[model samples]
Target: MAPIDLNLLTALDALLAERSVTGAARRMGLSVSAMSRTLTRLRTATGDPLLVQAGRSLVPTPYAETLAERVHAVAQEARAVLGPASQAIDPLSLERTFTIRANEGFVALFAPAIITAIQQAAPHVRLRFAPKPDKAATPLRDGMIDLEIGTAGASAPEMRTQLLFRDRFVGVARRDHPLFAGPVTAERYAACAHVAASRRGAWTGPVDEGLHALGLRRRVIAIVPGFLDALAIARQSDLIALVPRSCCHRGGVATEGLQSFDLPVPTPELAICVMWHPRLDADPAHRWLRQKLMALCRMPA
Candidate 1:
């Protein structure tokens, strides 16, 4: 079959509404001869005498009457689809669910405030927090996850990232532990047993490398997948848990009976960011969510 001309729908709608070649030409800002040609094309396309002359007036045929309303509706919808998104959105009126992929540490630190802010502004908006086991852009590119919060290491270069905050690692242990009685030094920190938090269960991290620079090493007695687990073990036993300072104080995760101290050896501060695919770059709702998260992170702790 031959391809149909979408432009003809607009002309047809004008022709049917005006019911006269001169009137349609005036309405569409075209000459009468041009409007006549358009009518001929519409007639050939529809295989019908859409307009018939009745004395000095033009009247629509049964076929034209049946198509008039449908063509007008379709034309209106097409215009809306092609037009710019200039209408303002009301958050309270918006109903949507956004999925965020992040680790437990981020959830524990920021989920409560984020959820509360979202609820207060957009009560109908729901958030789904998914587990991020590793830094992979597949979910973002494939549209499975709306946003990702974490370090951008190994992330796809095409993904857009905005730094949420800067966080430093801190040593956490149960209060009144022998390490807290006196000032913590490089050697004292290295001599203590530690719980390593690594998604891959690695026994070493930046802390170990820092200690190695001083010709010292900390014994990692256990390897855990997340910071919470490391803190859980550290709270019960004598093992020291190294976690982000924000995670320890925010959301009361490690603040109960655990004490956080600055690392004796310096490790680079981790940059936490929110990442998303370029597909959502211009989306209004997605932009709003990102703004909310960034503002929440920037709030005073």
Candidate 2:
């Protein structure tokens, strides 16, 4: 079967409303001859003389009058479809799972705030937090994860990102560690055994580089996969754990049991960001999630 030409509906609707060939042509940015030919096609399609001359003016036939309102409605809907898109996300009515892939430290740090905020706004929405084992973009590109939060490394150049906050590494250990007895100088900080957080376990990291600047190095007795594990070891033993101050949490407080002391030597500050594929940049639900995450992150720390 031959497909129906949608443009013909617009011409019929306009010609019926205006009741003048010249007027319909002007409204459609076409000449009178072009509109007359369109009217001929419309007549053949509908098998009716949709518009007839009434002296110097044009009048709509009974069939044209019957289809006027419906055609106009269809034309309006088509125009909207061709125009700019809309954001009609209804959070309260939405029910879907949003997968977020992030490092263990980030999930431990930011998940509570994000969960609370999302739950309060959208009761039915579910959050799936996936652990990021490495820096790769395949999950995002393939839609396995709705969002990825962490430092935007060289992984996903095509992803869109919004900076959430800046974080710096801090030395943390048991409350009664001897480093608290005096100033945490490079020598004192380097003398203690440390727990290094390296998923790949190569040994050297930001803290080591900072110590290198002072011609000092700490003994990394053990290498762990994540900061939380290192913190757990440091909490029980005398091992020193270097972790991001932003991710350390205590009950009802931003910085608690963790003793955050400025690094004796310089270390690069890392920016925390929320990243997602550019394809979802304008998606209403994705936009809501991004906005909620950004707002929740801005809360006083």
Candidate 3:
């Protein structure tokens, strides 16, 4: 038996990623003919067709799709192993920006603490908070986001994560609202006009689920995209808003005109987390950032 050709692995990963031989060739700066030969070599070496033509396009075989990510990861790891050791990070001397993608509520709740902590240790470092309109990791994979803070969703298995905090839902309205003056029941809570926070614009959520379980439903008069928007409308109107207790206590939301009460039904508690690409798992600066965040998160309630 012959030893595996390590160079071919890079070619294989690239080919699988692009599917098309010509596209992969352009990516690797090889001519179409050269890429075709490499693809032939790959098929012989792996004993898989890897990619098959479909009309004018090429598509990866199921096996090839499965290997694509792993192959890319393996090649990156090998490169890191052969490369020079990562240099020690100088917090004070470092001058770089880290972009964080998060929902509006999370940013309002945690950004100040994170920014202050980073500034205290690394004065030259800058932080950019970007809006996360949906649960997608494309920004992280593309190197646009240095970190993400939210409830863990369908993330790539290779991504790394750490729990930040646990938050439960709370019903909020104006401070002097009639609901605040009496024992709030499920029926009473459901009777009020509600402001729903539906990122996808759907007027339903865990609150609705809990209400459904109790054979009750709230009268949602308006649907907003984020917690901040919901809270804003609730503060000025008679509408009730279901908000995360932790978020409600954040600087922006924890203001006059807001009064929060426990939801009458048991709702799921969201486990907030910080996520990053596995490639940055061992980076000194990234490690430092994660540490600061973890420490802040662990502070007494």
The residue pairs that clash in candidate 3, if any, are none
lDDT of each: 0.89, 0.85, 0.85
TM-score of each: 0.90, 0.81, 0.70
Best by lDDT: 1
Could you tell me the TM-score of candidate 2? 0.81
Residue 205 CA displacement from its true place in model 1, Å: 1.1
Tens-digit lDDT string for candidate 2 (181-294) = 999999999999999998899687797887886789888899999888888888788888888877564223433455667878778888888999999998889899999998
Best by TM-score: 1
When sorted by TM-score, best at the front, the candidate numbers are 1, 2, 3
**Candidate 3 Cα misplacement greater than 4 A, ranges:** 1-87, 252-254
* Span of 10 residues, lowest total lDDT, candidate 3: 247-256
Of 1 and 3, the candidate ahead on TM-score is 1
Q: Per-residue lDDT for 128 in model 2? A: 98
Clashing pairs in 1: none
Work out how many backbone clashes candidate 2 has.
0
C-alpha lDDT (0 to 100) for residue 72 of candidate 1 = 100
